[model samples]
Target chain A: MKVTESDDVISFAGGLPNPISFPIEALKASANHAITENGSRLFQYSSTQGYAPLREYIAAKYQRVHGLDIHADDVFITTGSQQALELLGKVLIDKGDGIVIEEPGYLGAIQAFTLSEPTFYGVTLENDGLNLEELEHALQQPNVKFVYTVPNFQNPTGLTYSKEKRQQICEIMAKYDDVALIEDDPYGELRFQGEPLPYIGAGKLENSILLGSFSKTVTPGMRLGFIITKNKELMQHIETAKQATDLHTNIFSQYVIYDYLANNDYMEHVQKIIALYKNQADAMLNAMEEFFPAHVDYTRPEGGMFIWATMNNGASAVDVFHKAMDQNVAFVPGDPFYTSKTGVNTMRLNYTNATPEVIREGIKRLGSIL
Target chain B: MKVTESDDVISFAGGLPNPISFPIEALKASANHAITENGSRLFQYSSTQGYAPLREYIAAKYQRVHGLDIHADDVFITTGSQQALELLGKVLIDKGDGIVIEEPGYLGAIQAFTLSEPTFYGVTLENDGLNLEELEHALQQPNVKFVYTVPNFQNPTGLTYSKEKRQQICEIMAKYDDVALIEDDPYGELRFQGEPLPYIGAGKLENSILLGSFSKTVTPGMRLGFIITKNKELMQHIETAKQATDLHTNIFSQYVIYDYLANNDYMEHVQKIIALYKNQADAMLNAMEEFFPAHVDYTRPEGGMFIWATMNNGASAVDVFHKAMDQNVAFVPGDPFYTSKTGVNTMRLNYTNATPEVIREGIKRLGSIL
Candidate 1:
């Protein structure tokens, strides 16, 4: 059976967090409170501007945690980070405009920007972040509209940019008069190793849009996230685009999340998730180190979901994927993540959802197939 | 203060249902069931196609209620009818494409379609529906793309097409080989004063897309809606557009609505809303008859939220709106709904949200101002 056939399949394809990790009791309590206390407000057609308390909460969190001085007005709550990408794509990209993306980026971002039919330019990724030279080359393209980057613990790549590299990229972006930067930081808060680096939008880059989400930290299915931009004109355009898209994000979700944030130890909950994922990551890495061929290369991530593995001597990741699936072990082949011509030898493994035993067994099975 | 400043003002401007009529207890019970029975599924990322049971339920409802043979696979669940409109606009309307709309159509539709920057042609609406001559003239324009209409109880006009007119419009559309039709029927289920008429898409035409929603019937904040299209290729395009837009609609909302449909009586609830709105509509009509100037004219709506009122001797609706606001009564002016150069000396009054007493008193106050 194909991956889409059954829910019982030990699938690694979905970018979903462990269901066991959801704060179900907290969510239930919030739901009851929302319906009983603020039922009318919850059911009414709310302002296109999102729930005020939620926006203020997010803005304050961003300022305190990331040292980013964002105001509530600068934040636009979205259905998900997915909708934020779509709205930004709509407002920023004209026909044939160039969108610079990392060679291996999030597939959802690719899908969102594709609707606008913008030309894609792939920036090569290094250990620290996006390759600065390749990024400069892409930005030099005459119609380049914006560069999209997942700076901290990126999907598929599992790499975070160092502080120096982030500042360099920001300087390069500041030098460009026309191009804007979309810094997507959905996985930023999950860091388990080293000091947290500043976001690409942190310091002096004025022409930047930052996307943050509670999906990884809280729950993905709530479909709650937000976009922040310091530039008023760009924010206005995105706000209009949002109104034309879904009228507004789900107000009930906004209120529920706000209530949860207001009444709970959110940081403690996030720390628990981090500990769980960190242990899983370690198990997967240890299994790979023990079982995999010496020539097989992979990145050891500090935090976040994925580990990108590249097979040596041009061994095909697709072949291994098919063989491993027969043993009920599956991983996403890395070719889909890349916009370039070369992507046959790489695949992505996610450690967030599987148990330690499953990770060990699955990696061993994958190694046997390889 | 402006009408937008306070919720306490007598509002006929918002497209909202009566707050008193919401199935709050039922919804709360459904939500509790959803969280308890399927908490993991509710908190996990779901299929982009939507929750299967919800789609199946909607499809069966369409077949049973409207006599349309729709399958679950043919349905694409959306955030709301608003998102459905936005998705259709994204997939179908390329830049500079010609889209025909009724002269006084829904403002949300206009806003949703405007993002594509499509050239719009207005088909003048008569007592029955769209004027055939004007529609034919608009369709004669080279490369006319599609015609959008609300066949049952339109937004501002609250006019239902006669059965003969429906056939005529579909036949005309069939003749134009390249033209498509979008039948947006958000208010179709709320009929209280008229016999049921066949939907324009129910016939032999294979090029029509129909939109339906639970917003008006169930609750708007749930933001549950779906689109039905027989054109498979176009449906695939729309699915892709939906993935790009918001991944999928809220899984919890979908599950809650599905459980509610499964456990409770849907038609009985709809009947209650209809009875409430019907009384409110009658009160507004009665007040208009008693207090409005002799030369003022308005539609006697058979169903839905609105009654289109044209002022005496071509008086500006905006001026009347200002005067009414001064008297603490508010409504949407009609000019924004039109696609043509000519202004409509009209206003749209929604009777759904206000109590019968409030409607009568508000209309009397506006009448004195006029």
Candidate 2:
């Protein structure tokens, strides 16, 4: 059941960015420059906070992109956004501490935080974002450390929170001083059709932490990300915790990325990626509309990698997964994404890894299977 | 306090392997080859365990170098040995779990395990290794999870356990069903003068876990290390834990290291490092004997980066460190290495990063300051 599908199989399983999207030659040159220019510093122990220039670049980007007041020191570079989740778990969560998450949340975040042994309370998600009423209830719970969400282009589900909801979240969070918000914005730059929404955490910096990653826009293999916050004390705890985690993220990767940023325009590269993903997403959605029965419905994503579908008809996603496999198509069953057990007929399909041709073909096959 | 003491300062603070010790050209070539051959695979998300070939190579090295019957499946590549320490803390430690470390242990390990809030049992470090009586007692203590040690040319101390002691440790560990032994062997390959002692954990198998790294032997910047254990269940747990840590160690670094190992004779490079380090060690020892006051004492290390020094006179190491810094000669105070903060006049010196002439001058200045 875990077998890699054959070459003929049209797989919509991986949320991978297009392989051709990378400017390989530029990256290679940057690596070469890092080795030549930095000399031993590239290979030696570096500051646990991370390379200053890279941190500065990220800081500047955040200010420019989101209108946030992120200083260079406010950023602590991480191995990945996944690690940011783990570090938050390590620094903030104690055994049986209350952690608020969205229903059908990001699985990676769930996996990252579970080791801290927090008791999870999930807020139900609506079409626009997390249900505000449920989220307020979760936040008010005793010992709730933080409420974590991916505000833009969230994983598994392709929903982005509305601007009004973002403001209401900030106002709601201010009511509970003990509760913190974690707004993870990994795919914030990938919006294809809609105007970008203000990050809820961005407006409430004092009570929130922002996580950013280069995995989607750049190369995931470099494994670069950051935790951005206004809280210096929290950053210090994470920096110290990071020392124990891996001393720091790979200095070599840090140098290479710094050089790449200095020499090339990565935002331009991100734009190209956005264009490619938008086309693939359109193809997948169109195919589903044309071929899928009315009983099956999916989220019409404005941007990002995934399409979350729910079957109105009585069909188990697990059973459909096996049937799809037999038809040489694949997707992630969405039950595992929930902090609580639900979403039995739900599935998440990736539209980013494949081309328009492949995505259309895969969605057509999946539609027939459904 | 964090100043990198000027170019004029002959510092002995870092346990850094000489940058010149690495074959930079070979490493670059390997990086090129990895990108050219693997393409998207090098830049894509990889297995949580590691790149399979890299794990296989490490498993093979254990068999060839240490005669440990390690299977590829037994290995899990980490960001570095530091992360290995952190991962061990995550998987094996709970609040108040008993952790046995040396009195003056690796500071990185201390910082890593402290977050787990373990009850530490620090065994006295004899000239040869961990004091056997203390180790045996600690292993028998209730709720002891593991006895962690750097058995060969240990960090900050430069001590290697004897073969007889290794056998004794294995015997003692076997008696405790609940306790495990962790043999951290980052400096094992750099043994310059003494006969290679058997790894206690290697022989103990089921009751032990061994950590190996390319950081000291190759380059720390690439940040590659592995945990080898006969217990597959423990390895599986570590793999899952690692996913939340950083997804996996950088795939590009893994590919480059693998290619370099396949193409180059790294053992020959390590031998060269041993030869250079041994001469520098001799120079540092000789200078101490000639210039240091009679009240001061230091270790005569055979291999690896550090020599442990103790001032018998009631001078504070912190004071000595500041004075030495003013004199443009630097060394690390050994206070931080202690698990329970007893060492106040001990210091750790490194001889590998500088030439013999530099080592002699640095020691002379440090001795005068003391």
Candidate 3:
């Protein structure tokens, strides 16, 4: 058995954001401010409802940026968007309930919902987003509780739903009264191309719950995220579920982020990160175009860290992953991302952490191995 | 219909440690050092396995302080002791599986386990600890997956098990090979009286999992805790569960606590808190004895925040609570702590937050209402 190399290898297996993107100097100032201004409250066990000021900021952001009229009461701060998914799974998913997911969606979502032993229904992904027809068919099945979608630049696929598809999906969701929709948009702010589309939850859709994160746009290590919903019944259930989880997200992290947002230009900071990742993505895609086999196809992502690639001629992604690792480049085999047992010849390559030069070099090495 | 006040009352309701006890200066320094020295790593997504240095420190403390031969591999850092309980509930309990809990235990544990829909068997509590006869009877029930206990200074009751009871409980657990034990000891280090006893997990009890927390001793708002178990299978399952729940505990908080532990005198700091709480507890107890009716009875705890008080003649604690709140004093009624539907004529008071003078005044006001 071959032992895996340490950090010496250039790898795309990690879903980490660029370290340079973190506002460390600003955070230090915020930390000092928090200590000086509200040290006692920062250390205290805060309400399970989360910090009021932070919630207000988040609520205002949704309204001003996305044009969604969310009140502070509708927002629940979580340890991460991951925790929001878990809480939803706990509250909404009865044992053996069916949950729809994109064919190659996030493994974290799958893991979060799997604890409830929910039957997963996979909707095939097109260039735009989830296949609407497949999703409608899945919702027709008995016990289908909710549809989990990353409408923005998705985790592994890095695919965003087109405006037409987003509207159609929302329309289809409106027709189904029983099934709720979980719109997990962690990477929404990372878009590097075209105008931002309205969120699936932007319209007066009571059944849709939106999950947004500071992880991608701000700092992943802070573990701050939130859920927005208009359905009072569902929000109450999720809030209870959140209480049972970690009581609430860390008060200090929430306060620091609140302070940071209050003082800095969040959009500008996110744009800086988007610029960094865009350069890396361009380098990787250009290298892939130059060196990859003619039969291979990959998504031209608009934004986010990952680029989904599919090899031709029935080549296993796991096999490709092993070969790529040997070449000092690593990517997560896309099989785990799919709910179905049948493996696809696909993998996810993350470009955020790598420099432009490293991305080019790593992709070239991987191409040679392929 | 009368409108109830928002649940945001000055809660003696939560089992929170004194906010004053948090070493804000040390934490600020640690946070500064973590960001300044290791900003990139601190801000980056960390291993799901947890921060290595923090795990090593916790493991070392277990060995040095308790003479327990536990390795770092045996420890898993969690978002909080709350998440540890949540993970255990997810991995261990199946629907309809029986779990043994104290008659009046931590509400957080109850809420965490409720998601699994396990049939809870409540064991009666004794002055020292859990009633052994009741515990044995509960353990005899078929499909009892585990017995959850807080052996050292329990949450609501502030009771610690005697050395003999600990040995007997371990022997019984050994006798029943199928049954597992979850010993949550968040308040073990806060002992103000008697010498510290070995944890039940220390006696080569492979069937037990011990949970330790930095919350009560250091800072609850940091939300740092760990689970130690000898069972590798259970630990692995929990790690998977944790990955789904929140990916991992916040990396920055983990690093901050690790750095603080490395550079600061944690023991001395905790001792100061213990001394402060002991004085507060003494003041509260003295006030209660002087002011309360002769028929009212309460426990005099050696450590931890709570004092479980029972009213005579089935008097409603909720009524007393309302009256006390009207007099500007508040406490959590004990009924919600029980797994059973039957309400107990009792309430729990926390002495940790209030100063000696405040505690005495609060108790006097509460006594006047009763």
Local distance difference test, per candidate? 0.85, 0.86, 0.84
True-vs-predicted CA distance for residue B92, candidate 3, Å? 0.8
True contacts kept of 2: 0.70
Q: Report the error of model 1 at residue B177, Å.
A: 4.7
Q: Name the candidate, 1 or 2, with the larger lDDT value.
A: 2
**Tens-place lDDT digits, model 1, residues A315-348:** 7888877888788888888888887655489888
What candidate 3 gets wrong by more than 4 Å, as runs, is: A1-5, B1-14
Query: To one decimal, what is the Cα RMSD in angstroms of model 3 from the true structure?
Result: 2.3
- In candidate 3, the residue pairs with backbone N, CA or C atoms under 3 Å apart (3 or more residues apart, or in different chains) clash, namely none
| Shift in Å, residue A70, candidate 2 | 2.0
What's the TM-score of each model vs. the native?
0.97, 0.97, 0.96
lDDT value, residue A231 of candidate 3: 84
The 10 consecutive residues of candidate 2 chain B with the worst lDDT sum are: B1-10
Error of 3 at B143 (Å): 0.7
Give TM-score, chain B, model 2. 0.97
- Give the alpha carbon lDDT tens digit for every residue of B1-370 in model 2: 2674468777898777888887787888888888888887887777888989999999888898778888899888999999999999988998999999988899999998997899999998888788888988887777999999998888889888878877887787778857778999898888889688788867564768999899988889888999888887788789889987788899989999999999999889888888888888899889998889998888776677899988899988888888988888888999999977854889999888888988888888887877
Chain B only, TM-score of each candidate: 0.97, 0.97, 0.95
